[model samples]
Target chain A: MSPSLSWIDPGELKETLSRIGISVDGPPAPPPSFRPEPSEDQPSPPPTPNTEASPPPPHFEPVISVAERIDRFARWLEQLTHGAPMSIADPEGLLIEGRGLPEPLALASVALDRALRPIRGLLGTHQVGSVTLEIDGGRLVQTIWVVTPIGRVALGIMVERPLEPGRVELVREGLRRVFDW
Target chain B: MFGLTIASQKGGVGKTTVALNLSYAMARRGWRTLLVDTDPAGAIGLSLTKKLSQAPGLADHLYQHTPIAGLIVETKLKGLGILPTGKIPADESERFTNGLADGAVLKAIQTAAQGRYDVVVYDTPSGFVGATLGAMRASRYVVSPVQAEPIAARGVMRIFEVIGALRAKGHPVELLGILLTMLHTKTQSSLAVAEDLWKTLPGNLLFEATVPRDPAFLEASAAGVPVGLLRRRPPPIAMVFDQLAAELEARLAPDAKDVANEPIALVD
Candidate 1:
């Protein structure tokens, strides 16, 4: 409930519903995701900038070349987990390099791009920073981005089954070390 | 010419029936009309004509380079045309899912219809997903046929929410009106719900003409003809659709000439 609307009485609720032509005897329906602005007496809420509206332009034009970086990362990921298909894409979702990815995963990347905006929006709104998708029942795909000093890089890995807690930590640590974050 | 999409988020609300009959009514009134079926289920072909059920259509035009003009079939009713949703292959569905955008397809269909038809009516799929959004983007007007039941009325309200969201994003589409279908006056609950919606919903959004629950519609559909075009002297529900057509024409009459002159290029 919004702080300002906390003062609303039952009579006002009926009156409001009446003005909207909803002649309901019960209380009016609650609003979805309403957040009232802070009053003068209250301290203002922390500013949450809409980074999506004005994302910083990509900073890195890698001198090492994209193909070289992709090859290096693919080799490193192979050492971390054997026989697991993986694909690496930039923050813009263009596939940089991939190895052993199934046809469905390769083809579903476009639909997956549509999900990225909503995932970013959810991250912006909430504290959740990482997202995972379960594909083909048991197959799991976890994605996390590394914000380096130069630019953002998104890495995704697909494994045969759901990752154990220790394996998830290992994956995160591997990404952190691989990106030198 | 005005491009209208008869859409609803809920199924079995007579969207195909409305699209077919309305096209016939407009054609009978000396307007060249085209009905485009975008539903993958191909209900329009089942209801209107079965011969073209497996015919290649919109998907073919989008996936392949098949011209939209070649896909159009002349219906039994004079002055009316249909572009059926014919045989989309598995790979084509994969392409659509993999971002074969509808912008080009919408442009092709509308550009073809512009020179030949006075109105293009799109009968969309049930949910407000990819095909519905594509149709809405191409259309200037959206007229939703809402079933005269509580749950279906909620779906009608949901359509308004989607229309508002589209307009907020600067899309030029607008809601024409909500047509109440399958009304049974003898039932108190139906009459009460209709009366409630009539009084509560905002100005001029509900159509004055209501389609009664009649077996004539099913009979006409089973016989593969619009209720308005049946061989009988006058089908029982034909007058209801005629009145609806007259009202719609009157509403669209003021800008009809202006719209005919200014068809926009279908690109983002």
Candidate 2:
């Protein structure tokens, strides 16, 4: 989905200047010069309000909106945990793949079913923030840690291999949210 | 299946070197060895390779509710596998031993490694008693490497205290062997220290081999190469390790012959 951003109006410049205690009667024009004064630096040029947009004062990265962060984290968690039965879905709905079925497929199907139950509650409150690629033998195993108000919550990952660094970051953000780290 | 944890109450006495060389020595001789780096700092993993950059190390598995296998890594070398420590925070000791013994972390490491490796060698954290005890419980034998110095020998007594504490609690751990590391050929202090230890400690727990104080030991460690594989004109350290591995095998599983006779079936 294309994210819609609110457009800023230049007219709001007046209000912004007032915030810094600058009188909005735009700086007074320099006295009219017949053929602008050309002496060696004889006349003061009109104080050109530094028009260049000063980059916003560096601040702690603004708190990420809760929903947006969650979405990003979910994508990473899903990618890393692609085929594990205990699959976590976006912030709300989920399907936990049960351990393989008893008769091979039968028991696994059941494990997949029960695993999804905790995800909805997890999604509602947390964002996946970090992914730990655990190695089991030569293959990959994933555990997604989430950040929340109380503490870090770990979501069992079902992925069989490791994810690239870029993808791991998004999941880390989500987990940081779920775990409150 | 029994396990051995080679650790030190102190650092730089060839803990990682011993652990890595012993691991490589065993692996090269064909005993499947699984090395577990439980130091949240991951020095053991660092000595083995340069690939890993973060945690989910053995310690991470304990706090996070998940399968421990997620942290195990198969090294580039043959026969030696590793379970690396995860993003080790500077305060892992504070967190790991907030209340419980550091061994709590190792219990999970042991559980995770069961049935997977014939020999699980844990390179534990230095200083605190908790990490040592944690390694002790999960390990069948606790081997310490002491440099031939007054202080390193004193450290041995300190380790014995920690082991004695564990024994009082009913842990079946044994002081497998004490390796007098970093031997200097001309120094009387080193020779005296080794002699004193032999006289004081029981004969069964001491290995006949002594690792030499050589520049190659540090260079190999810096290059991430084991002494056993050093292509340069290696000092006696490599041979000492070869002997150390054999002594350890005979000490731990005496019924088994040299590493040549054993074929360890690896996990994966």
Candidate 3:
């Protein structure tokens, strides 16, 4: 038995997304970032760090609230990287936030977080380190472990192509500002 | 009884997913449906309410003379039952191979299913091989799944040819439609393939439902439930299958005068 009905073409989905201002190429860019665009004439301000002797004890009690903050940080990283994806996960390997990274990259970042957790225990207070993970498809992911008062914060920056050292340092600086570490 | 086989000549065409979820949808609509897993590689058991035991299944019913009724397991779905492709002994695979080639096994299965189910859906394996032939032989209609790819679209021709040969041989089975599956509209290539298929295929031979590629299926598979039965709100993909099921029911209504004709007489 067969019925006469018009089937929606798959291309229609692309058209629908386009109507909603979403790109078929990838996830839509973060609404042009809620933060104000820096004026061209004004020099960019350096990240400001709290100079207090003891930073407020890492607030770990409400994991939900901390997770929300992590989302904001992830969005900020998205803006900072000009839409380059980033994966952020807690020390326990739970994905705190992520954008643009492929599924395999996100899952791999979780594993990386778990792997780097043990190493964080042996590091000194001021030590922050980055490791490069070679993945399939000849891609590379640069993951940084920033020591926070609460625990280690793992962030992964997906590298689509070769980049300069200054660009990598800017990503690290963004992480430091976002996590306040 | 109306028996529909969800089959394909290519792998990864979403036959099992469609068959299993369609059964659930049919059951929800108050149709007493039975989903039979003819494909040895099918993960139908994993998506069912309970893990199907490694007991004798259709193979035993065919080769060892186990009662088909005994092998039919009730699922969590109210009006649905599952006859799993249970653990077939390594030795029995060869025996069944010969049985399928001769069409004896399928004829027996058809006879047993007669008058018992409102709809019996069979999930067949990849390719137009032994298992697929057995399913095709027993069904009144075939739903050929074609993945949204050029090669997969070409495979749809083989299914039509099989249905044609069966029709010429006096078997009354008909091709219901070609279901496009695993379609990712976000990708240009996926869109190109789908558009090409739509233009090339006869409009009536394409179901109105297009299953989008979604991670929700994986979530449901992992949770051992139909996409519609996922714990949270059912995803859009789930709704797509539900609509497809409803449309199929309308097309294959039991009271639709054409269905009054008896199936080809079971030889056995």
Report the C-alpha lDDT of model 1 over A28-111, residue by residue, as the tens digit. 222112223337998778787788998886776434322234345556676766635555444444334444343236334534
lDDT of candidate 1 over B95-151, digit per residue (tens): 442222243466457788886888888887655656777787778888988766544
lDDT string for model 3 (B57-124, tens) is 77777667888888888877777888887775433443554456445565566567666667778887
- Model 2: residues with Cα > 4 Å off, grouped in runs: A1-181, B53-55, B97-104, B232-236, B253-268
| Superposed model 3: Cα runs more than 4 Å off | A1-181, B90-94, B101-103, B253-268
Q: Tell me which residue pairs clash in candidate 1.
A: B1-B260
DockQ of each model against the real complex? Answer: 0.02, 0.01, 0.02
> With candidate 3 superimposed using the best TM-score fit, by how many Å does residue A153's alpha carbon deviate from the native?
36
Give one digit per residue, the lDDT tens place, for model 2 in B120-213.
7887655434555677787778788877654456445555556666666777667777787876656655665666665555455567777777
DockQ of structure 1: 0.02
lDDT of 2 by residue, A1-181 (tens): 1011111123453344333233335432222122133479677766745557556545565544333343345444435554232323222212111121011122222343346447746787443333444444453334454444533344444444555667666655656563342
For candidate 3, the docking band is: incorrect
TM-score chain B for all models: 0.89, 0.85, 0.88
Q: Quote the RMSD, in angstroms, for model 1.
A: 18.2
Which docking class does model 1 fall in? incorrect
